[model samples]
Target chain A: MKDHAGARLIKDMIFKCAVCLFAFISLLPLYLILYYITKNGIMVINWDFLFSLPRPIGESGGGVFNAIIGTVMLIILSCIMSIPCGIAAGIYLSENKKGKLSNTIRLCVIVLQGTPSIVIGIIAYLWVVAPLKTFSALSGGIALSIMMLPVIIKTTEETLKLIPYHLKEASLALGVPYHRTILKVILPSGISGILTGILLSVARITGETAPLLFTAFGNQFMNMNILKPIDSLPYRIFYYAMSPYPEWHSFAWGASFILVVLTLALNLFARGISVKWKIQF
Target chain B: MTDRTMLKERFVKWVLITFALSSLLFLFLIFVFILAEGLPLFLKVGLKKIIFGFKWAPTKGYFGIFPMIVSSFLVTFGALVIGAPLGLSCAIYLSEYSGKKTKMFLKPALELLAGIPSVVYGFLGVIYIVPLVRNYLGGSGFSLISTSLILGVMILPTIISISFDAITTVPKTYREASAAMGATKWQTIYKVILPSAKSGILASFILGMGRAIGETMAVIMIAGNALKIPTSILDPLRTLTGNIALELAYATGDHRLGLFSTGIVLMVIIMALNYLANFGIKRKPAK
Candidate 1:
């Protein structure tokens, strides 16, 4: 009995060690990526790299200002297009949960979420630009909005659903109408979750390269027209990295580093906010 | 006197319903657009030629997708093989061995992994992993194996988090019952905890598969972009996503249509996998 008990204890120890080892192994690649990106990519960061316009071949000094501006512009435009639609749709779905219309909407949302970003780009190309005969930031922004909608709708609907039905009932019993109750009471309660969804959509759009390739294309010089071609950070990174110029490659690294920082900050911030809301499981 | 208010409320509901229906319309339009653009390409270029032909020189009219399909499968499988086991073991460990303090630290770290962009992973794989593989393996300098390894690492967090949640949800009573039987700890975990957690493990595995299959930038960066059937892990290969990314810029006419068809094929494969997974989960929700 003593020998059998000792064998059992030894086996338990081995199992625990194996588990720890697996956790460490899972983390190894992320560490390597972070370590290399900081080391190789940090050297190229400076004011000129951040502030000047992209340059042509053989020119040494240029910044990715155009790309940065375009990315922000596209993101803002996408928000304008998607936020109202996504939120309203989400609210309708939650309010009318059992209806056939809501069921159809729910299925659509799931399929959209799974559709690849590249395919979205292609569809945008066919519908938005094929008629207009011009590729513009507006087209790119619309494609991104479609991509962002499903994420926002899914999260916001779930969050709104979490607001106790009693709150709605109480407001209604006090002579408030359903729409007013939703607008004033439930939405406020669910705002944090809504913001989390928005932040997640923003993070998702920040890295997207495929959709913009055919829609927004890329511009080397800074331009502000929504109806015209615009440079974005992802396109700039793709172009500069693939170019033959060393300076272009360096600029790409700097842009990538910036992109990484922005995504990381937003992601971490969203996580922190969700925790602060202190929602119960 | 209250007629105006009733009218306004009715208007608001109508507006809401219109917006909701439009969201569904969005999905319809996009899928319709894909089928419209892609179906013509299949008719023009026989399915057999597109599927079986080896050469993909579109300019020369030798377009084939077998190499890309093979590469995608191989890379996805490689990632699964490397990532799934580690993730499952970590899930097992988290559920069976770790203290609360350890789990609190570990879960967030895992989440952080999910947040990192594929672009950064691509840059990392290119700079660090490709060279390591090249130096160690001593064949084609950049190869499918390195890309697969990077994908494996990138997806580990997804597998671990989902499976961990699944395993932890297995009732403690199950573990206690096994322990009370005087079974060894390893034996209890293997026989009792894992079996009970099978559905969660299966779900996580499917999610991981979805991620691996759809991944673009990281695999493109390290897969060497060679269009060939790789006989060895050290050979270069191209995947469907990478091929689209590379060719979408200059492609025109039927070439453009062919690319969309490739996208359709990818979507079909992904949907099939998702269907299979959802079916499995529905059949055995208890797991």
Candidate 2:
């Protein structure tokens, strides 16, 4: 009996050690990526790097200012396109929980969410870029909005579903119109969740490079025309990192650092909002 | 109800329904566009040749993607080999052994991992993993091993979080019953709880596999984009996604059509994996 107990203790010790080791392994890459990017990227960051535009080839010092502006524009445009549609879809799904239409819509959302970003990029190229006869910020935004749709829809549906059914009954008892109840009560109650979803989707698409590759097509200069080609942070990183110039390599690292910071900030912001707005039942 | 109010309600309902149906319309549009663009290649080159033939030179009209298919599978399987054990173990630790404090810290870290962009991951792979592999394994820095390592890291969040939830959903009574029978904690976990959570765990694994296979930017950055089958872990190879990403910018006409065909192949693979994952999730025991 003592021998069996001793064997069991040893087995428990082994399992515990294995679990701890694997957990460490799981975090190591994340730490290393953050460490390396910060170590290298910090050296290239400066006031000029933030404000200046890309110089011509063979030039030593150029900033990703154009890319930064372009990324912001794309995010704004995408949010404008995707958010209302996403919220309404979410509302419909929550309202009609069990039906063929809801099931079909849910399936479509899942499939859309799983579709490869590059494939979406290609489709956007066929749909918008081909029709426009040029790569445009609008096309890029349209592609990203498609990518953002499923997440927003899912989050909104889940959030609205969490509201107690009694709240809707109370509104109806007060003789509120159905449309007014949804617009005034349901939407306001779920606003925090919808906002969180929007922020998260923004974070998700901020670093998207694949869809923009064939849609925005990467401008070299700082131009603000929505109908014209534009540069973005991810596109800059992809283009610069692949180039042979050592100077461009540093630029890529700096852009990467900025991109990571933006994404992390957006994530933390969303988390903060969700925690702060946790409804007490 | 008055006619005015009734009209307003009807208008709002239709508006909401239109918004909802747009997602389905978008999905249909995507399928139609991709198929319309991609199917022409099947007629030009034939399906059997594209699927079974080994060569993939678009310029020479030899667009067989067997090599890319092998590469994508090898890389994804390699990532699974490295990621699955670590992810499952971590999930087990979180669900079965870790304190609340540890869970608080680890859960957020996992979220941050998922939030980090694929391009940032690709950059890191280029800067670190590529060099380490080239130094030790003796090939161009970009190789199957490097790509797999990066993807393994990328998929960890998906696997760990989902499996953690799965393990947590197992009834406490099962563990109590096992303990009452004089089984050790490890024995209870191994013999009882794990079996109950198997479907959920499998679902996470399948989803992670899909993510790893569909990954493009990172794979393109570190996989050398070579058009041949890798002979070893140290050898460089390209995937279907990588092939399209690398050449699509300059491709025109049939070449463009061929990339869409590659997209179709990838789409079919991902959709099948997704269906399998959903099935697994559906099969999980209700709480």
Candidate 3:
């Protein structure tokens, strides 16, 4: 009996140690990335780095002001294209849970979520960039909005689904029109979740480089026109990092730091909002 | 008056339905466009040659993608080897052993890890992983080993979180019954809990494999984009996605079509995997 008990205790200890070791290993890369980016990236940041346009390849000291502006513009454009469509689609899914059309739509959204972002970029290039006869911010926006669609739709559907059926029933009983009830009561109640989804989708797309590779095609200078090629932070980082110049390498690190910070902040903010406004059934 | 309101409501419902159905329309268009662009390559090169051909030099008219197909599988398999055990153990720990406080802290950290962009991961691979591998292992730092290491980390969140949920959902009564039988904690976990949660665990692994296989940017940055099949984990090799991204910018004519064909191949692989995952999910409740 003593021998069996001792063996069991030893086994338990071994299992515990193994679990702890794996858990620590899982988190190590994230910490290492944060450490490396901050240590290298902080050295390159200055007022000039934030506000100045990128200098020519051989030049040493320029910033990514245009890329920053371009990224924000692309994201805003993508949101404008995606959010209404996504929310409406989500509303349809939540309202009609059991129908042939709803099932097909849900399946499509799931498949889209699983589709590779690069593939979507290629399709977007064919649809938007090829037709436009040039790489444009609009093409990039269209590509990103496609990527954003599935995420937003899924989140909106899940959030709306969680609302008690009785809420809608009550409004209908009080003689409220169906459309008005959904627009005023159901939508307001689910607004926080819908907002959280939008923010998270934005965060997801903000660092996307693959979709924009052929669509936006990276401009060297500041350009505000949506129809024109534009530089984005991710594109800039990819270009600079791949370049042989030491100056460009530093620039890449700085852009990476900024991009990482923005993405992380948006994600956390989304989480914070969701938690704060979690509605009880 | 009521009829007027009814008409307005009907219009709103139709608008929402149209918005909802548009995604399906988009999916159909994507498939049509990809196939329309990609099928020409099969007509020109022949499907068997494209699938079975080992050489992938687009300039030389050798578009055999066997090497790339092999490389993608090897890298994904390597990542699974490294990631699955670690993830499964962590899932077990979180679900079976950790306190609520530990869960609270660790869960958010994992979510943050998931939220971090693939490009950032690629940058980290280029700056840190590549150099480390080059110095210590003695090859181009951008090798299969480095990619596998990064992807192993990348897939951890998917595996751990999903498997954690799976293990948690296994009934408490099973654990108690095992304990009642005088089974030790380790025995209960290995013999009872794992078996019960096998379907969910399997689903997580399938999903992880899908993520690793579809990963493009990070793999391109670290995998050296070599055209040959890797002989070992340390060897450098390119994947289908990497091939597309690397060449698509400069490619035109048949070369462009070839890249789209590669997309068709990747899409089919992902769809098949997803179907398998769905099967696993569907099977779990039945068990």
- The TM-score, computed over Cα atoms with residue i paired to residue i, of candidate 1 is 0.94
Q: Write the per-residue lDDT of candidate 1 for residues A208-250, one digit (tens) a residue.
A: 8877877898887898999888999878877776566767777
Q: What is the lDDT of candidate 2?
A: 0.91
In candidate 2, how many Å is residue A245 off?
2.6
lDDT of 2 at B140: 90
> How much is the lDDT of residue A75 in candidate 3?
97
Model 3, stretches more than 4 Å misplaced? B285-287
| Candidate closer to the true structure by lDDT (higher is better), 1 or 3 | 3
Candidate 2 structure quality by residue, lDDT tens digits, A1-281:
99999999799789788888998889887788788888989999999999999999977787999999999999999999999999999999999999999999999999999988888888888888888789899899999999999999999999999999999999989988899999988988998899999999999999998878888889989989999999999999998888878899899999999999999899999999999998545
**DockQ measured for candidate 1:** 0.58
Pairs of colliding residues, candidate 1: none
lDDT per residue for candidate 2 within B177-259, as digits (tens), equals: 89999888888888898899999999999999999999998999999998899999999999988988887877887888888
TM-score of chain A of each: 0.92, 0.96, 0.97
lDDT of 3 by residue, B159-260 (tens): 999888888888888889899998888899999999888888999999999999999888888899888989877789999889888887778778888888
Which portions of model 1 show Cα errors greater than 4 Å? A1-6, A243-247, A279-281, B283-287
Report the error of model 1 at residue A70, Å.
1.6
TM-score of each: 0.94, 0.98, 0.98
